[model samples]
Target: MRVMAFDYGTKRIGIAVTDPLQIIATGLDNIHPNNIIEFIKKYLQTELVERFIVGEPKQMDNTPSQSAQHVKGFVNLLKKTFPEMPIEMVDERFTSKMASATIAQSGMNKKNRQNKELVDTISAVILLQSWMDRRLL
Candidate 1:
């Protein structure tokens, strides 16, 4: 089974999923927040996801960020909707910035570099990758 993750935001949610063996994380989609559950339901018809991960935005001093309340609500909904699946949260402090830097170095054009949706998706991948790495240690 694979693992999935979300970089949640008020506007759009960035999605990422791992291969069945959970070796690599890949950007899956960037969709409206309201569409997340339905998208996951559809995605589940074809994929076996063993666990879900959500990026937990935190402040520089490690307190929950202002958006954390919003993320908590999202998590609660996920729990109510899919109680069977396990959900995990990981620190998401720098994933967006890291994603931006990564895209800058990828030789993509300025137009694509400015795509917030692309950055969000990349951030999800980074978040999932970090989670997998933590499991290794």
Candidate 2:
């Protein structure tokens, strides 16, 4: 079973997954927030995901950010929808900026770098990688 991660937002939710060996995280997709359950159900039919890491929005002062309420609601829905699945919330403070910077530094074309979906996917990947790194430390 592999690990999965999500960068949840009101507009779009980003997805990432690790290889079966759990060595690396890769961006998977960006989907509408409302479609997550159905998307997950379809994905699970093809792959075994043992754990999930959801981005926890937080302010600079370490308090939950305004968006945290939405994330909380999503977490509740996720828990109720898949009672047996394991879930974790990891602080996601500046993943978007980091993703944007990484994309810019990668020499990606300006048009592609401007893609919100790509940024979301990379943010999810960053979230998962950080969680995995923390585990190894």
Candidate 3:
């Protein structure tokens, strides 16, 4: 069973999908926030996803951040759309920072680093990979 992961943002939503065995996650595309629900619904109809893992942003103090509520709403939408699929929240405190650091370390040009959509996709991969690791343990 494959699992889909989302890194929800105000303007864009990043997507990633795990292997059928749930072993690895690959970054997909960043969809417009306004069209995320439709995109997800279409993807679910075409793909064989079994569940969803949404990144839950939290402050350094472990408190829910503003983005967390947005993510929650997105998850709620997914639940309403796909009533049978299970949805889980994974802590995503530093995934963006990690993605940025990784991009910086890779020596990407300034223009690439500044691309929010690209960074968001990478962050989604980070979020999904972290969830996959935790599930293995």
On residues 33-125, what C-alpha lDDT tens digit does candidate 1 reach at each position? 899999999999999999999999999999999999999999998999999999999999999999999999999999999999999999999
The lDDT leader among the candidates is 1
Ranking by TM-score: 1, 2, 3
Off by over 4 Å in 1: none
Location of the lowest summed lDDT over 10 successive residues in candidate 3: 37-46
- Of 1 and 3, the candidate ahead on TM-score is 1
lDDT of 2 by residue, 1-137 (tens): 89999999899999999999999999999999889999999999999999989999999999999999999999999999989999999999999999999999999999999999999999999999999999999
Off by over 4 Å in 2: none
| Each model's Cα RMSD | 0.5, 0.6, 1.2
lDDT of 3 by residue, 53-106 (tens): 899989989899977778878888888878999899999888888999988888
lDDT of 2: 0.96
